[model samples]
Target chain A: MFSSMTISQLRTLLRAREVSAEEVVISVFDQIDKVEGDIEAYVTLCRSEALVQAKRADALLKEGNAPDLCGIPIAIKDNISTAGLKTTCASRILDDYVPPFDATVVTKLKEAGVVIVGKTNLDEFALGSSTENSQFHVTRNPWDRSRVPGGSSGGSAAAVAAGEAIAALGSDTGGSIRQPAAFCGIVGLKPTYGLVSRYGLIPAAPSLDHVGPLTRDVRDAALVLQAIAGWDGKDPTSVQKELPNYEAVLSEDITGLVVGLPKELLDNELDPEAKEAIFGVANVLESLGARVEAISLPHAEYAMASFYLIASAEISSSLACFDGVRLGKRYGEAKDTTSMFMKTRGQLGIEAKRRILVGTAILQEDNYTTYFVKAQKVRTKIREDFQQAFGRCDVILSPTTPTPAFTLGHKLDRPVIMYKSDVYTSLANLAGIPALSVPCGYTEGGLPLGMQIMGKPFDEATVLKVGHLYEQQTASERRLPQKEVKANG
Target chain B: MELSLKEMEELALIARLYLTEEEKKILPQQISSILDMVHSLETVDTEDVEPTIYPITGSGVLREDEILPSLAVKDALANGPDIVDGYFRVPRIIEEEYES
Candidate 1:
């Protein structure tokens, strides 16, 4: 089906006029119609708007000057603003909040002539590792209906995997993008910090949050990244650096490339099957002419703890704007402003409330140095570890998650366990480096396993190149979850 | 490191969130466990290690000091739950006695 085709494949057909953009949109909507009820990946589907954009793309295609992403149906995580569309971060507070403007990435995608299929679900405020924290219904794994599509970008990952959308955008604060991508069996890239602008993203943790693409393959991710990565005047943190053509490096040779496997990251918590998959990927990389070596990131053990403190502290401050008077749902009746604030803010989901409370506590005068500043110092150590590791290798390789997608509700009540699932993925966010998760292999149970490739700051080309080469070598292992979906249906 | 219920309630108050009865009952333990997990940072030696607050290191970017078009009043107030005279309406901050 057209929905199952990659952007690279569709770009050729589209340019050749072999298929109309409307046909592609219709095909995607057909897939969505068939499986959306089962997968529950989308919070909102812009069927009519997507059709309208497809029509515009068809006109642009006829002129023979359309952009690469013309007519590609894509899903956007609901946390990223889309003008005039409800941009609920899966929180009841902002359930009716429609953004007045598009996020920088959204605007960039629109300018590229892509059709936005809809906004996908996410963890409330993008704070949780599982979409179960979402106030909305949980997004089921397309691979196994009984399993969770890893989150907070679970809906975006699941949609791309199920062919509901060709590709989607997800923001990674701490494994929000890569872990879900790993769980859903797709390519998810979190570009180096400052590589992508974050002007209109509802912040979960501003310093660590990164907007990136989740796609069917590495090439599509490169395409999307090429279109969106750059400095934006609106986002002060956006780096003023020249962006490399990400697609240009995908075919480059890795004959002398050095890949490091950090012993510290390969913890006892890693599933035996996942451990085997990591070794399997290392073997594939070595066979493809890349050198693999064991390396130590000594400070890696503290990344999770440091990340939580930093993330929660930032989330508390960022979400303070959602008072009852302005945007978002206003709840309860009160005679005083304090009561008004309490009533409205109290509606936050359990995970969000927990973070806010923890964040507030961490930033308090007595606890600031103990928790917040200390985490920041450890964050420096973690970044220094990556710098040291990169001195000996081109990229770091590890399992994206301890295991593959777990059964739904398995870790919902256990927030700490759910947080632990991000151990392999959160370090990249903390270090502000580029990380990519590509499907490595499958578990005996048919769940997808992911191999993570992390590179130095502003070195997305290297990361994408390594992931692409690995993907090319293991092309046989690439399979969609349609068979399981069909069985469930 | 375990927080008392009273302490948890105070933290919630500081955060401007009203906890439900269940949250009041469970949050102290939940927050305390999370705190314990993050307490691992205390073990790391950070002597003389400068804190890295923002990932990107540099001076902030600045734009020209020129007037630019911004959101219209209508658009700005469009999402407001309560609006009065093109302004956000909120509960009275000053009571009758204070106003006098």
Candidate 2:
């Protein structure tokens, strides 16, 4: 019932009594049961509870005072706490942990009557550029099962791409959300750092993390963003802006809009085909009356070093809470307290240990300024570079990732190479600007390629307007992998 | 690429991970590759730029410094495997100097 419909279409059908919320819910689970074994996109599926929520949504509609998101099923990234749901962040450490309170995003979604479908999988603790770091199971790219959907938001991206849910929530700390969305060919946004409330997101890094929307279409992403964007006393950093008029912004014309293409975004490292597809997108935009221009963001290339030094240093300290003390799974049996703490973290995956160790080292006396603080200074320069570019452009456009999705386990022996895959997406996060990844085209292998649009800080409306325009031109680029597979019994 | 075995041990100790000797052997290459990336930032002129530490700027988010109650001892111990006398119990820590 829902495979071809947009969220707007589904809402219309639901309100018109053309379809029941229960039917849409059943259709989604049928798809999940059909493809999830190979996709591994969902970490926990609460089928019984989801049906109950769907039923409740239907009842509220019947009563005729339904919430804005009534009957829409959405996936929650496992890292976003949902009061009683087991949110493991795809890590062994958080394996059985469930939060006592819902994250602000989840609470807001529920308040708007969006049915919680299930918890999506991710790289453990939202580290790693690929979902291979997940302790439970790696999420396979829906476009090609052998490939990875870029992560640490891979499961949320893959699930939305594969149509397991209408939309999903994913977090970005240094490109987690946008990279996966780009890899999976969906619309995903990482709001300006303080634009969305971060009250319940498990901290991978305190300052860089952002919670945003992932949807099959730009309109749905904007719709979800509208429902959740606001300041909260619970999240001190959340900006107290008026709830965004995202839907109104969707109609804003692209005519005469000034768009910048950074030299770094079109660098020599970008694959020829990827560059062509992105430039092709720019051409289409120009044809629609938007002016495309080239501008230089000199510090753009150094964003990764800046991201790692600052983010990992914070990760080292933020994760110190899991000393087998307050939260997370406990460790090896031993008589002494110190050994238990040691053994517990020892049980964490190799990737986690590496990050924690690197984080600690960067914060050490000799390396703190020479490495970490210098990186922070570079970050300031990058932010200024963006601020200067915004003076010449309404938005910045680029290929979201340098290349398309790569084969899974292709990066196991060489982890740093995987981190480089996020180069294009991380800078927007570091500069604390809103960025969106929209599906642009399919590679010859049937994998999707995406283009990213970044806008001024807290100006998500501008990003949404540009993405909505881009998505309109590339409407038929929507992808589905299940047509080639048999349904589960 | 020049991380000594001793430096890796010290780093691992500070990171709270217990790295085996084999893992320590692999450290220099990993650290070196990362430092290779860091070297690029060294050339950039950030002379007048103040460090952008926090993404969100705020001068004062001060609260009334009143003490707030925390979770009870039982709730605190809820996730612990072994505990005694209101403290999590673990093996005695070793006093080491990374064999310096």
Candidate 3:
């Protein structure tokens, strides 16, 4: 089906005039209409807007004045701003707040002539691992109707997996992209922090925030990354280095590449199936002439705690702007300034409130040195651990998440349990290294299993190379989850 | 150490959040447990360790001060709940603040 074709395939078809840009876009919207009731992937869909953009893209494609992603329909996580689109971040506070400017990545995507389908749902402010925290609605895993498509990028991942969009963009602070990509059985890359401009991405935790692509395959991820990764003067933290041609790296051989298996990540704590899947990928790499070895990263045990404390502290600082002042839905009668501000912020979701409160507590006068400073110091140790490990291996391999998608609402009440979902994935964010989750296989329950590959800073080429190689070598084709809902006649 | 209700309330105030009575009742335990989960970080010896703030090694750049067009007043006021005279109008702290 046109909807199931990868960006590269669709690009070839469009360039060859076998399928028009409008046809692909229309198929995508039709697919979205057929499946959206079952999987609530998007919060705001730009139907008419996308049709207009598709017409423009068709013109560009016909003129041969377009890039590889020209005429492709892609979804943006709600947190990424598109000018005049309501970028809610899946929170009520910004429900009606349309952005005046497109994010740097959005601008780049438009320049490439890609059609944006709409804003996908996310954990409110991209705070949770599950879209259950989204104020609008919960996005379900296409693999299992009752299960969560791992989040805070669950909507983006779900949309791509369900053929709602050919590919989508999601921002990862702590496994927001990778984990959901795993859950949805697709390719998700978290580029090295600062590789992508964060100018218009609503910040969850700036220090850890990264915007990357979620695609059905590794090559498509590379295509999207090529378009989006670059420095922007608007984002001072953006890397000033020259962009790598990710597409070129995909064709490179993996012979003699040393893949590291962190001993800590493979310990008895992992799900048996996930552990086997990682080892299975190792075997595939081994057959491909790549060597896999066990490596130690001792400080990784402290990653989850360090990430939460550090991320929460940064989130507290970044979210300080949404006090019904600059742009957000205001609540209650205007009493006094303090009360109005308090009531306005009272509209924040429970998860947002939890982070804000804990984050505020950590930054308090008495706790700053104890919690915030200590976490920052641990962060240095975590980065050092990766530095030392990468000294011996080209890339590290592990299960992207500890387990496949957990049943919906399983860990909702237990904040600690929910936080554990990102334990294996957050280490990359801590070290500011690049990581990608590629579908390894599936568990017995038919849910997706993900294999994670980590590379040294600015070495996304190697990471994508390894993932692309594995994706190419694996003989198994992805088994799409059986659809549970059918369109009414 | 688990936080008491008073401590949680203090945090809520610091966070500028207004919690419901049920939230006030449940949040202390929740926040206390999360704090407890992070308490394990103290076991790590971080003495004399320099904190890493920005992970990238490069120093911040100083851009040349150049004049650029700013956001249009209409776009700026587009999402505002209340606007007056091309500015976001908030509850008056002092009448002279918005007197134009």
The lDDT of each candidate is 0.91, 0.84, 0.91
Candidate 3 C-alpha lDDT tens digits along A1-489: 788789999999999988888999999999888888889999999999899998998888889768879999999999999998899999989988899999999999999889999899999999999999999899988878889999999999999998999999999999999999999998999998788999999999998999999998999999999999987888888877877789997898989999999999987878999999988999999998899999999998999999999999999889999988778888998767777788999998889999999899999899999999999999999999999999999999999999899999999999999999999999999999999999999888778899999999999999999998888888466666424334431
lDDT of 1 by residue, A297-324 (tens): 9999999999999999999999999878
Q: Where is model 2 chain A poorest over a 10-residue stretch in terms of lDDT?
A: A480-489
Candidate order by decreasing lDDT: 1, 3, 2
Candidate 3's interface RMSD, please?
1.3
Task: Please give the range of 10 consecutive residues that has the lowest summed lDDT in model 2 chain B.
Answer: B56-65
Please state the CAPRI-style docking class of candidate 2: acceptable
Segments of candidate 1 deviating more than 4 angstroms: B98-100
> For each candidate, C-alpha RMSD in Å?
1.2, 3.6, 2.1
Q: What is the lDDT of residue A307 in candidate 1?
A: 93
Off by over 4 Å in 3: A481-489, B94-100
Interface Cα RMSD per model, in Å? 1.2, 2.5, 1.3
TM-score of chain A of each: 0.99, 0.97, 0.98
Best by DockQ: 1
Q: Tell me how many residue pairs clash in candidate 1.
A: 0
